[model samples]
Each structure stands twice: as structure tokens, then as C-alpha cells.
Target: MVVEGAGPSCGLIDGFGRHVTYLRLSVTDRCDLRCVYCMSEDMSFRSRRDILTLEELTRLARLFIARGIDKLRITGGEPLVRPGILDLFAALSEPIADGSLRELTLTTNGTQLARFAEDLARAGVRRINVSLDTLDPERFRALTRGGSLARVMDGIAAARAAGLTVKLNVVALKDGTEHEIHDLIAFAHAREMALSLIETMPLGDVGVDRVDQYLPLDSLRRQIAGRWTLHDVPMRSGGPARYARVAETGGLIEFITPHTHNFCADCNRVRVTASGTLHTCLGQDDATDLKAHLRTSATDDVIVRLIDQALGRKPKGHDFILRRGASPQLARHMSETGG
Candidate 1:
């Protein structure tokens, strides 16, 4: 079932002409944690039939990799919650190891990583991104409803012990968990891992509908009164992001200011949801039903055309933070967006 024309044949000349290399794949829309920032208490999950089978996922990955997607990221409501996740990793990473793909990574809530991190690393997951909003136990319990801070902490240790390139993702909210910024930085520095403080995007079901608490990351950066210099890590040669290391005598930190600094200029990625839709941008809700297409026209040429069209439709970049009217694609819940 190796589709022919899908062999790295389709790409476009963007305004700057960068070939898209990264692809984020959502394996399941079901997550175990009902984080206050994502879904509500009674939010329903996507039907089981909607999720791509492991074979279907591997086939999709193969087709995309054949189309010049060099880097792959596995995301979900909580990627690990999906059954056969490690097997999925094995399935996806084997192609990369065999030279059909270049990189493979996973994003998880860290609650489930403690038991599986070592196995994931062994299965060829080179990098890991763990989501942790607050360090305070009670506050964490509040932020991610029913999540235990201790469990997440153990997961982090397990991930580090497994030799994965770990990165901590923190969503900075104004009055809620902004107080944990310094603590997060200290933790990352102590463990020699990258800590990225993300600006809260207004994209969630009930959690973000109450998005009034979104923090301006620039203000967060400026509030660090202590003199610390940042050294730019060039991403222009590039894969996923434009990152910098914050340096000050004894320690350093990595900050990903995606909102303040629009990496979209050099953005070389697209996302496919768990149900098999191709999304050009998380902020712009333009997506094509790749799953339906796969069921009908599994031909490589047809798939390539759809991917090229989707890439061409990618918005210039998202300016929702600056604009007031409202954005159509910007309001979907993060759970649905797989990030």
C-alpha cells in the first residue's frame, strides 16, 4: 500500500520559500485530565470510531514523511492516555530510523510519563515535552482538575532519567499562576532542561472561555528585574522554533515567546488532528478532512495535492493578540487542537 506520488514530491514556494518540514500528529482526542484550561467537567470526548487506528496512523505518517515532512510530533488530549502509544511510537519511529523520517517527539501531561518514559525513550522517541502549569500542589490541583503535582513531578524525574531531551511547557496566566514563573525557571535550571513559558492562547472549551486571565509574556519577561542576558539560538537554519537561552552567571533558561515573536515567518509545520483533519495553523481553523480522503482516494497523487493545497492555505500568521474583532479559527479548545 505504498502510495506512489506521495514520495516527497509536493511542497510550495512560500513568500520566503521554506519547505515545510514539521508535522504534528494527534493520535487521540481523549485525555485523562480535565485541565481547567481545556475542558469542563462534563465535556464529552470524540467517538472511538473517529480516532485513527494504529495502522491508519502509521500509514498517514508514512505518506506525510514521503511528502518531505522530516520532523514528527505526537500530541493529544494526553498522548499517553491512548492505548498502544508506545507501539505507535515504535511504528512511527521505525520509518525515521530506516531513513524515511528524520525526528520524532512526544508531548504529554507528565502524569502518565513516570511509568512509560523509559520505554518511550527506548522505542525511539528522541525528545519529550511535559506540560506543567503550577508547582504549588493545591494550585496545580486547581489548574489541572484532579491532577496530582507529586505524580507529575515523578513523571518529570522519570523522563529525565530515561535520557530524553525534556522540555517543560508552562502556560502563564496573569493572576492565577504567574507567581510560579521564577520557580519553574529555577526547576528547569536545576535539572538542566528547557522551560518554555507560553502565552495563553484563547483556544479552549470552558477553561479558556474564562480567558480573562491570559498573561502578556513580554511583561512577564520584563518583570524579571535581575540582570540576565539572552543569547539567541539560531532557528533560521531551522526545524520548529526560534528559541533563546537566558544567561546569567550561574545558570541559564530557554524561553519560547511565540506570540511576541512570530515564528510563523519561518514556520515550517502543519498539524493533523486525531480524527484525520489537516490543520494549517492552530490559530487559523482551516483544515481539510484527510481521513475521509484517505478512505476514498488513498492515491499518493491525490493526497499530495490536498497537502499542497492545505499548505498554500496556511494563514500569513496569527495576530489575534493585537486584533479585536475576533478570529474564526482561533477559538477552538486546545484539547481539540492537540496542543
Candidate 2:
């Protein structure tokens, strides 16, 4: 039954006293490319009937906004690849107009941004995060399993021309990508865009050894400090990344060290998959089947109660360990979890 007058609460506070305000909601679990760190090759995607519809995703977004979620980031294997995705963006932008949502952003692979950047800007999306691990055309192609670097570059340019702020998300790889870090930083700074280096996490068996791919951000930071001065900044982007200012380039750089330095002590975000599974902790397996409640004729109060229960089960922190010949910490791929 549809229950009326179920007003919003103060906010979603977890058992650890962290007020949750940011949500990473996935629109689809399918991507255009097969990144080695994100998923395995020849993978199977969810059937259309298994995923949430645009209307249902929109309703869930509004419910989260009413419950004090200020920042919403739409993610996916590749969100733009989903058909009718612009409709979802337009629908979610409604909360931004009324000030219920502080930001409406997305993290995309940038293959389709050239086609939708203008529409996205018109729909109230102010900023976007584009994943670009390498700048070399051949390396980029190999890294993304045949993705076109030129396409990504064009999409980024189109996004900039459309007046949307862009941030580059790079996955730091130990396999000789360290030498390109300075170049990547220069590229981002030259384009007036912020860049963040992320350490590879053992989320799934991508057919590659985790130990070989793991590049600790702590060591990488020291290496970066040798060439350029990195001054720690107090700025936060409502996520796990720690900010720093590169004195040489006068640009912003960030490090996301899930293993080297855990940010779970002040965790204030939650993630929901395209299938409606609410994961309170990224590394943990505990999840609430939000689709079960969403598909039923459950009222707002019922949904809220389910969310509260899930938050109560949030663990203290994640235990991520990387060793030789070890399996992934979680069986579910990062793609499935809304990377």
C-alpha cells in the first residue's frame, strides 16, 4: 500500500554515529570496455528484467534525497551505455532544482560523453568523473580491452566545451604505470582538471594476480613528493579520496588508499547496485536487498526501516589484504558493485 504523510527524518545515522549524506547509485552493471582490474573477460551481464527500471531508480533517488542524501553519484560498468539514461538524469535533476540535492554527478567511462555531454549539462549535472588510467593510445586500448583513447579524449573535450567540470580517475598500476604518473598529472593540470590516483583493490578475480597489480598509494605518494611538492589540503569531495595541492602544477591531486590508509573511521557514504542491493561497506559482503522491498507494495516507512536495519549492520571497517596466490576478498566484481 502507498502510505502518505511519511515525512523525511533528520538523516541516516549509522551505528558508528556517521551521518550518511552521499550515495553512489548504480544505473547498470554493463560496460563498453573490460578493464582488467574491474572485471573478468567474457563476463555475463544482468538480464534486463533483473535490473531496476528508470522509474524505480528515480523513485529510490527521491526517497534518498528526502532522507537527507545531499550528494548523489550515478555509476555503472558504464552508465552512459545504458539506453534512456538521459531520462534518468533529467528525472533526478528535479531534486537539485528544489535544493534537496546539493549535487547531481556521474562517473563514466567517457565513451559516450561526446554524444550526451550537452544534454547532461542541460539536465543539471555540474561535474563528472571520467576514468582514464593511461594516456598512451596503445596502452589505453590494451588497458580497456579495445577502448578508443581518441573517443575518450573527444568526449572529455566535449564535456569541457559544454561547461561541465571534469575530473580524471586513474587506477595506479604497479605494472610500469608508475613512470607515467607525472605525465598524467601534467595532462590533468594542463587541462585544468583534478586527478585522483586510486590503488587497486582485491574486489574480484579479474583473471590477474592481485599482488602483481597492487600499487600502494603510500609509497606512490612518497615517490610523487620527490619530484613535486605535495601540500596536504583540507578540501574534501564527499568521498574517500584525500586531497593535496601540487605546488608545481598548481593543480589538485588526490589519493584513494583503501588498503594503505583506511578511511572507514569517517565513512559517510553507501552504495546501491543496479539490481537494488544496498552495500553499506565497500569491502564487506553485508548487503540489504532493497529491490525486494522496492518491488513489493512497500510503503516509504517500510523502505526506511529496511535502510535503517542495513545501516545498523555496518561493520567497523573493511579488511583488505593482498598476498601471493590469494583469491579476491569478495567474489562479486567491482563492476557489479558500481565501481
Give the alpha carbon lDDT tens digit for every residue of 1-339 in model 2: 232433346688899888888899999999999998998988888999889999889888888888888999999989999899999999987778988899999999999999999999999999999999999999998888889999999999999999999999999999656888889999999999999889999997899998898888888888889899999999765467899999998999989988898878888899999999999999999989888778885567778787888888888888988889988989988888886
Q: What are the lDDT scores of the predictions, listed in order?
A: 0.75, 0.89
Worst 10 residues of 1 by lDDT: 320-329
> Which sections of candidate 1 miss by over 4 Å?
9-16, 207-211, 225-229, 236-242, 249-254, 322-331
Collision count of model 1: 3
Model 2 compared with the native: what TM-score?
0.97
Best candidate, lDDT-wise? 2
**Runs of candidate 2 exceeding 4 Å displacement:** 1-9
Q: What tens-digit string does per-residue lDDT give for candidate 1 at 1-339?
A: 576755566543344576778888998877878877677677777898888888778878888887778788899989898888888888876887787677898889998999998888887887888888888999888887777999999999999888998888887777865577777777777788777777766564463443465676778776653545666665453432445666652444444555666657677778888888888777776878888777777566777677777777788776545333343226566777787
Error of 2 at 314 (Å): 1.4
Give the TM-scores of the predictions, in the order they appear. Answer: 0.90, 0.97
The candidate that wins on TM-score is 2
Q: Candidate 1: lDDT of 142? A: 80
